[model samples]
Target: MRHIHDAPAGLIDFLFTELLLSLKDQGYSEFSLGSVPLAGLEARRGARFSARLGAYIYHHSTQFYNFEGLRSFKEKFDPEWRSVYVAVPPGANIVAVVADVVRLIGGGGRDRVGGKASR
Candidate 1:
């Protein structure tokens, strides 16, 4: 999904359409483009600390992630988005839960396969 923004107008769209058509020909009825982290988060009254933090990061962390562009690219397909939720038990620290989820994303202490990403 990491495409050059300078690509000619409609080039990305053409490619995406072809890909989807190919998948359909393969008898695939659905396609998942995966999660766009920090996308669609909003800050409002009574929002949880984690939600607010996610919103702030989404707005200010473009140097690290092109959240807006990615979200826009994914939206072209009329995709359905699922909500992300974190469960914190009583007395649990939200920061710790977030950190653990991040760790799980980055190899998660699992043994690498052929020195590549985790299985």
Candidate 2:
């Protein structure tokens, strides 16, 4: 897998946008925008749609810097949390995965193992 660390911020933004667009194109009309602070609080306000059919599906993070806090927060929404995984090629450096996980968790350090600078 191509590391996000090597990509420019513009590209990363573009890719994220592309992913959203792709989800929309794939019939995900009522996509839930998540990961913002207090997402659970907002979700508890009530369904975006009527009771007959729920308006939006909550997409939540399985991993958080504060895992317990995040899990507790998301649980308030009664979301059906799912597991997601990345399929990498055989013999991929585990450190890359570790660095990626750290980065995702807001670890803002240069990727010395890959000789890449964090933006």
Candidate 3:
């Protein structure tokens, strides 16, 4: 059973709100929607050089990636955004590590877990 309101919140939104409320009641302080890589970068005064470059790429590279859509979906939950970065060890093969991670995440040409790609 659910209460009907003048403006009905969609099921996904309603469930998300309930989840957040439950987490709060259980004393959880934060909810994290993991990064949409290279999304939501913005240039601001005193921002780092890498961040400025990333922002430029995000704004300009829509054809190459779906940065806007990724950001929009995450924004629906009213979550705060923060920059995340990875550090590599000296002499490590970054490309290999990335490929391994992609494979592990089932992003390498197929979904290993469900056997279907998620839209």
Q: Please provide, for model 3 over 1-119, each residue's C-alpha lDDT reduced to its tens digit, 9 standing for 90 to 100.
A: 22367656576567778998999999999998666665655798898655576677657766755556667767988777787666657665544543343344334545445343333
lDDT (0 to 1) per candidate: 0.71, 0.45, 0.62
Collision pairs in model 1: none
lDDT of 2 by residue, 10-108 (tens): 574466568768988998865442342223323436543221121121233344334345556445545555444445466656446544644644545
Q: Please list all clashing residue pairs in model 3, or write none if there are none.
A: none
- Poorest 10 consecutive residues by lDDT, candidate 3: 97-106
- lDDT-better candidate, 1 vs 3: 1
Instruction: Tell me which of candidates 1 and 2 scores higher on lDDT.
Output: 1
- Quote model 3's TM-score: 0.45
Cα displacement (angstroms), candidate 3, residue 103, comes to 6.8
Best by lDDT: 1
Q: What tens-digit string does per-residue lDDT give for candidate 1 at 20-83?
A: 9999999999998776766777888798777887788768767755667778888988998997
Q: List the residue pairs that clash in candidate 2.
A: none
Between the candidate structures 1 and 3, which one is better when assessed by TM-score?
1
